[model samples]
Every structure is written in C-alpha cells, then in structure tokens.
Target: MIKRQAREEDETHTAVQGCLRDLGKSLGYDVWIAANDRNRPLDGGKLGDGCLGELPAAVGQAPGADAVRLIDVLWLAKETGRIVAAFEVEHTTSIYSGIVRMLDLALGPEAHALEGMFLVAPDGREGEVKAQLARPAFSRIADLKVHYLPYGELKANREAIARFGEGMKPIQAIARNLV
Candidate 1:
C-alpha cells in the first residue's frame, strides 16, 4: 500500500510537470521549478536559488508569510531570451494570504529579472487574488500577470495535454508526464 501510494504521488507529480511543460511551450518559455535541494536557501538567509538571481531580505511583516513561503516555478522566455517570470501556486487552502506572501518574495530582486510574477490559482479565484495584489506594496511590482487555471479546465484541455505529452521529449509517455 505504501509503495502504491508513493507511485500515485509520483504519477500526480508527473502530470503537474507535464502541464507546466505544456504551458511553457504554449507561452514560449523554458520552465523550471526550484527544487528545495538544488535551490537550497543560502546562508540561513530568507533567500534561495542563485539560479534566477539574488533576493534581498524582507522589508515588513505580513500575515501567513512563512506558511506560503516556497520557491514556486521559474520561467525564461525563449523569444526575448530573458527570464520572463516566476510564479508560486497556491491551492484552495493557501489562497489569498499565500498569494500575498508570494508577492512579497516576487517583488524582490530575484523576480526583478523577469518580466513579471504570475499568481497561479485554482479557477474562479483569480479575481480575488488580483484584488489582494492590488495592495500598494504588491502593485509596485509592475506588469504582474495573474493566471488562473482550474483543475476542471486542465481536465478538459485535451490539446494542451497532448501538446505537453509531445513537447516533453526524451522521456517516454508515462515518464514525460510524471517527470
């Protein structure tokens, strides 16, 4: 049972990876998610991953800041050959508060390399998330883009799934989606 559960978790992670890969292709960017180990926090500071760039320390206290703190995904735009954006996904449970904290991190220097930060949430929640982002501190991060992708939308988008399956090359079908 434990093995089976682990396998299922692996499968789910694969699917999410496939989706991101597809999204990258669709948007024309090279996508990467910061891994905890590879992008380990530096000097016990509130920063991680020298891959994108350096991030400075936080300025002020914010609610639910720590819980929502996680390196989300990073993306580099292929067309312009520049780091386009980095985003952190916040599920239903994490929601508004999580986005706020992510905005705090994204607005820092590391994210400045990108065109903007994306707040990816479950469907029907983009509006609220956007509203929260409208706060003065977050609004300073110019050109921020908010993308909301619901689970249902992902389920219905067969073309996207197919594209992802094809684009994530070298890996077999199962591994492509799983990895």
Candidate 2:
C-alpha cells in the first residue's frame, strides 16, 4: 500500500511538471526539467529531451547547483538564459526540500531579478505548506515571496492559459502568494 501510494504521488508530480513545461513553452520560455526527472515521458518525448541540454548560466556557479538541478521545472529566457521562474511541485515529497531549493535559487547572485518562485502542491496541502513556511529555517524563503500553486488550480486552467495567455501574468493570477 505504501509503495502504491508513493507511485501515485510520483505520477501526480510528473503530470504537474509536464503541465508546467507545456505552459512555459506556450508562453515562449525555454523550459528546463530536472536532470533526474528528465527520464519521465511527457508529451511525445522524455521531459528532459524537450529541455535545454544545459542551463543558460551554469547552475553550478553556486554551491547549490546539485539541489538547483533537480528543481521540478524552470522557465528560462531563451536568448539570455536567465531564469524567469523556478517551480518545485511538492506532491507528496518533503516540502522542506522544495523550499530549500527555492532558497538556493533565491540566494544566488541573480536572485533579485527572478520574476517568480513557486511551490506547486496539492490543494489540501495549503495549511501544511503555510505551517512549514512559518518555520525559522525558512525565513529567507518567506522573504523571497515563494508562491503556492495548487494542483487542481493548475490542471483546471492550464489548457486555456496555454492557448490564450500572453505571459507570466496568467500564471501569477492563479498562484497564491504564500507570503
């Protein structure tokens, strides 16, 4: 039962990642899938197959490159390689890790310029997410304004947003500001 539940959770996370990938592309950003998650089939090919072979800027410039690499999804500016937004889908995994990854990106040299950072999880997890964010260790994340996007919300509007949305505004509208 535990194994089955874990598998289902992983599938949900993957589906969320795939939706983010599609939305990023539709909004004209080059999407990057985590190196480990690249193997998962999404759309017509592997998730990482559709992503850039390398980060526009080497993610390893900072000490958190390893953590940053596994960020569920990243929307980067195609020409400049600047990360426009970073997302971590916390389906059933540790929210602590997701927040930590956001911190890695937030503490990077270009932190101030990032357009957005988000934690995407199940709708019911909002209270858990809020409580976790309240922890002292996540102080920096709170300051950085990590947003929350529920799975149901993403799934509900992704198609319309993909087809008609002009830029990040549509996504932002759906994402709840965590802090």
RMSD of each: 10.7, 1.5
Off by over 4 Å in 2: 58-60
lDDT string, candidate 1, 54-144, tens digits: 2222211333324323445555654443445545555544455545545655555345555444544456665666566566655543454
Task: List lDDT for all candidates, in order.
Answer: 0.45, 0.85
Error of 2 at 47 (Å): 1.9
Query: TM-scores across all candidates?
Result: 0.45, 0.93
- List clashing residue pairs in candidate 1: 14-177, 14-178
Regions of candidate 1 where Cα sits further than 4 Å from its true position: 1-18, 25-29, 37-69, 77-82, 95-116, 141-143, 152-179
Model 2: ten consecutive residues of lowest lDDT: 54-63
Native-vs-model 1 lDDT? 0.45
